[model samples]
Target: MIVARPVWAGSLSFGLVSLPVGLYTATDSHTIHFHQLQRGTSDRIRNRRVNERTGDEVELDDIVKGYDTGDEYVLVEPKELDEIAPGRSRSLEIAGFVDLSEVDLIFLDKIYYLGPRGAEYGKVYSLLEQALEKSGKAGIATFVMRQHEYLVAVKAENGLPTCHTLHWADEIRDPKKEIGDLPGKAKASDKELKMAEQLIEALSMEWNPEEFHDTFQERVVALIEAKRAGKTVEKAEPAAKATGAVDLMEALRASVERARSPKVTGGKAAGPGVIAEKKPGAKKRIRSTPPTDGNGG
Candidate 1:
């Protein structure tokens, strides 16, 4: 196993109990960005700050944050407003404990591994780790990082304390409000449902993260490389358009067939798709029918 270097030294607490620990990021992201260029001349793009209403170029020092209160009125901020919230950051404090299964995976925004910071705090940190491991539970905690207190989950992972960001209840928007309404209130036919279930079972496979790759990003990079080498860019086949359908039975049947097919499922055996409706025990099956608009044929 590779050892991780600590990024921040701190202590975790819950009323009286405290453990000296260090934090290290659990993952890293690599995203590609493009530089803008002029449409015809191929000159690099440049941005300037200008007053929207007056069409005047504004200097950096002259720029001030503002909010529109409506009716063409604006509220400008003063320089002192930048230091609105200021205080010495405190270490992670675990206020409570919870079952590991209770929290949803979507709530986790970031992950960090906590290591024992010093020899003196080793005993206390070890004790906490052991207790959490023994109970097979995680601690519900809050930590102040970058001046903002974040809700997090703390648990013992591979003999080390691990922290993951938590999503508050308010942060989760209600799907009903966004979805408005759904079609096909009726359930699927026995044959359709059975076929779907069989297709799912036939395509089952173990989770191996290494097998996955971001093909979209890879294609973009490959295109750039081809352009640099003065080679022709490959054109991939256009994706099939989706068609919406009112026939619940037909949709389920099509999906079941697709799921069972090796080519459609990505391989001889592939994991289920992420659509919640397609999951077993789900009340409704969201099928990829053609679009309601003429975009799909």
Candidate 2:
């Protein structure tokens, strides 16, 4: 088996205990990138760093970051930023542990796999992982990587620990301020709501990421292959037109029936978790379990 390379190496500390660890990227992109070229020509296009005023090419070592202060640009050296970092570059210090459920999903960013740096540190790593799994808590920590400070939560996942970078609290925008036309607590008729709930119940299924694949990417690859062989390719069907408000109730009823049909679900009907007929004055218990992983971060 091929071993993965660690992107960042550091020591994780909790109180007086410290364990050497490394952070390995846990995800990869399947995007097909293309090179820039002149239109209708095979000539490649390239970008270069240059002095804007002189219109001359500049070497990478000569480039320095500049911050504009309205009147003038304040140039700063790369080393100056590193000197002012809050803590040791190789140290990841845990501030405290909090219940995993308490972490707001909005604050999460990228995830990395945290592993012991060497076989000697495996015991320490396993101890932390098991403790976190049993307690159902995540350790909140701060560390510096590549001259940038990161706020991260270390949590246990499938016998390993994963480090999830978190965004600063102030970084999240206020949705009410950002979205002007949000309908706050808009009331719907009980009949329409009940029908909608039944539709949701009919469509509900257990989460299994393995069941899904990127069909669009596959289609793109097919298009490339077809073009290479000088063959025509069929286009995908257009998206279904949305139902109007006048047909909303009819749409919901039809959706519930369609979801319950065996032909629509590969010969198996919707599971027994579906909600029953609405009873008068009964409480509505909608499923509120948000997905654990997504691109929101």
Candidate 3:
């Protein structure tokens, strides 16, 4: 088990079942960083805040967080805000249970791993995971992180519970409002659709995350390495074009074929539970129909 540097510690409760757990961030964005430089002299560029009308460097102490009101007006600090801030600091309190599938994917923000706080808390944590895994449910709760209240979802993950930060429904924009209205018809021919379906079927495979590479980051790193070695950085060649078919159906089929090839087989993968024992010849499958909401969250 990984010893977690917990960002927050609190209780996960639903009905009579309660367990002490800690939240640790699951995702990290620790890629290499770069700074802007003057091209010929290679001098590092530094930012300075100055009024456009009268050029002058602003002192750091003079900075304050503010909100823009209308007409370029700004709302500055208020002493009343300090008085009414949420009392709780770093704590995640589980409020209720929900079917994991009911929450839309767009609501998901950051993810974190929930670990048992101590040996005594292990049994309840395992029990909750087992029960939730069997029932296909997740716990929905509100918690305070960095003094801001957040809606979160805790679900069974690898014999433990994992927490996901969720954005409020109002925070998400409705596509209908932006796109106006979407067409309700299949514009392509039946043959084209059939080819597309076949392509998807051919390409279908288990999710193995290691296969996906952040090519942009990789390219940047390579360029940096080349520059450090006093070598000329080369531009990447254009990607090869697909040769299978010209229509949409052919394109999908080609994609499927590529996906199912031996080169795309196996890599690191994860799901919601521990693999206590491997089931021989078993393959995980995505449900054809959407999961029903499990009421007992």
Candidate 4:
């Protein structure tokens, strides 16, 4: 396995257990990125930090964080902040453990893989991962990373402890208040509910992530390739327009009928864990159905 460079070096501390660990980024984005430039020209658009009042470009060394305090700004020096940081700001302390599901999905932020700092620390790391996995618990912890103290949850991912930073409780906004006229007390009729459920059943799919594609991104790449080749590129046909929702009952019934009609399933790609195995030459038919790890640290 390819190991990534550690983003932070810290120890996971709990009742008499301090396992030295390093946090490495777990994911990398694959989206194509672009740079800003002047229209019709190659002049790159650049951003520079300048003092708003002085209009002078500021040096990185001279930049310091300041909090607006109504009357004056509270300037905090890095050294001063470090002086009051937890464990001299070098360790992540597990404040407590909770059932993994107890944490709200809304609070989840970013994930990172955790690894033992060295071969000697492997034993403690494995012990913690296994214990948390068996208990169905996650260790709630906090630590400084990139000069900011983050609230995080530690859990196992593929038999190893993984860290996921979370949003502070106060940071989560109430959806009811954020959205206007949300159907807080909306109710569905029994027939409607049943039809909805049946429709979901017909269209249900296995958790095969490979079937999904970033079609837009693929088209963008194709465009770039055509330009590189100096060939005339054909524009893709416009996407099929989405139909308006039908009367609930009609939509559900049609969906069920569509699912029950058998089709060529022999070449259909199955998702992981969808079927134990696929046997070639087996007379497989698609039934129209309707419907449709982590560790603790």
Q: Against the unseen true structure, what C-alpha lDDT does each candidate score? A: 0.68, 0.80, 0.66, 0.75
TM-score of each: 0.68, 0.85, 0.68, 0.79
Error of 2 at 250 (Å): 0.8
Ranking by TM-score: 2, 4, 3, 1
How would you encode candidate 4's per-residue C-alpha lDDT over 1-297 as one tens digit per residue?
Answer: 976789889788989999888888898777998767554344567999999999999998898889999999999877777777747368989999999889989999999998898899888999999998899999998888766889999998788999999999999998888998886766777887888788788778799877877776776665455434433334444455664445656766777888867744422221111112233443432111111111101
Query: On residues 1-297, what C-alpha lDDT tens digit does candidate 2 reach at each position?
Result: 999989998899999999999999998889877776554344567999978899999999999999999999999999988888735788999999999999999999999999898898888899999999999999999888888888999999989999999998888999999999998997778999999999999989999999987776776676555444434454454569998888999999998999999854221111112112333443431221222222111
Output the number of the lDDT-best candidate. 2
Answer with 2 or 3, whichever has the higher TM-score.
Answer: 2
Alpha-carbon runs more than 4 Å astray in model 2 = 263-297
lDDT of 2 at 108: 95
Determine the C-alpha RMSD for candidate 3 after optimal superposition of all C-alphas: 16.4
Write model 3 residue lDDT over 1-297, tens digit each, in one string: 966588877766777666777888888795888666554333568999876677877787676556766667565554434445444433455666678778889999988998888999878888878987988887788876654678988887777778888999899987778787766564777877787777667757799999787776766665455434433333444567755444556566666677667664432221111112223333421111122222211
lDDT of 1 by residue, 45-90 (tens): 7799999999999999887666767766565555344245332144
Cα lDDT of candidate 2 equals: 0.80
RMSD of each: 12.6, 15.6, 16.4, 14.0
Worst 10 residues of 1 by lDDT: 267-276
Q: Rank the candidates by lDDT, best first.
A: 2, 4, 1, 3
